[model samples]
Target: MLAVLQVILLVLDIVWWLVIVSAILSWLFAFNVVNARNPVVDSIGNFLYRATEPLYRPIRRVLPDLGGIDLSPLVVLLLIFFIQQVIVLYLIPAVYRAGV
Candidate 1:
């Protein structure tokens, strides 16, 4: 139904932001801009890792090694954007036509 698709869209949006935040946090950690030793920072990093790792793992497996670069987050964000577009441009319209 439309409601279900909307929920899916909402979840995707949340995930999209999480991925962005995780990526930014990673860069901060890499550049030593954030203190990893601090309990608060460590906890936030761990939470983000746990939240996004499952989504990134599969993509990481398929992607080629790029030395120090990690592209999984970018790939995940693209896939999420693609899914959101499909849901918005096609699926929702179809649902409307079907009177659901």
Candidate 2:
């Protein structure tokens, strides 16, 4: 059980980090802070989009737009938090403290 919680926490941590990185990269890409001509950088951007888009799409549809600035990621983050902190933690109370 301890190991399972650790693994879930580790996964959640990874997903959370990916969300941050994806957000930054997305901003940089959107605002042209980073050069997109580099194949590797472009690929990274593409990969991030692929990974994050599914989570964002439904939220995007439901949430009102912020003057064209999407707030779906915020919604998605909230959902993720609920899943990790509420759902997972509640489901595995014994493991939650150990994981944290």
Candidate 3:
């Protein structure tokens, strides 16, 4: 059961990385660095925005706008990655248990 939990945590970490990549790509498309005209880019960007927006929305409200810039995405990324690190720490217990 401990080993199974470790595997689940690892998968969660992977999913967080996927979210980060999607957020970055979405920003790139929005800024026109990537061709937003492409159908695939459009779909991916919209979907990413939808996925990540809920986290950003509340953060955006409390935080002051930095001259129209939104730092909520950065905040979301940091929080998600930090939680992933905590999840990885659970594996040490699983390893110790396996030794016995």
C-alpha RMSD of each candidate structure in angstroms: 0.6, 3.6, 3.3
Per-residue accuracy of model 1 over 20-95 as CA lDDT, tens digit each:
9999999999999999999999999999999999999999999999999999999999999999999999999999
lDDT of 2 by residue, 1-100 (tens): 7567668778877777778889999888889999989899999988888988888888878887679687776777776787788646575775566664
In model 3, which residue pairs have backbone atoms overlapping below 3 Å?
none
Ranking by TM-score: 1, 2, 3
Report the CA-based lDDT of candidate 1 relative to the real structure: 0.98
- Which one wins by lDDT: 1 or 2? 1
Candidate numbers, best lDDT first, in rank order: 1, 2, 3
Count of clashes, each model: 0, 0, 0
Error of 2 at 60 (Å): 0.8
lDDT winner: 1
Looking at model 1, the pairs that clash are: none
- Number of the candidate with higher TM-score, 1 or 3: 1
Point out where model 2 deviates above 4 Å. Answer: 87-89, 94-100
Per-candidate Cα lDDT values, in order, are 0.98, 0.78, 0.74
Please list the residue runs of candidate 3 whose C-alpha ends up more than 4 Å from where it truly belongs after superposition. Answer: 1-4, 7-11, 90-100
lDDT over C-alpha atoms for residue 67 of model 3: 88
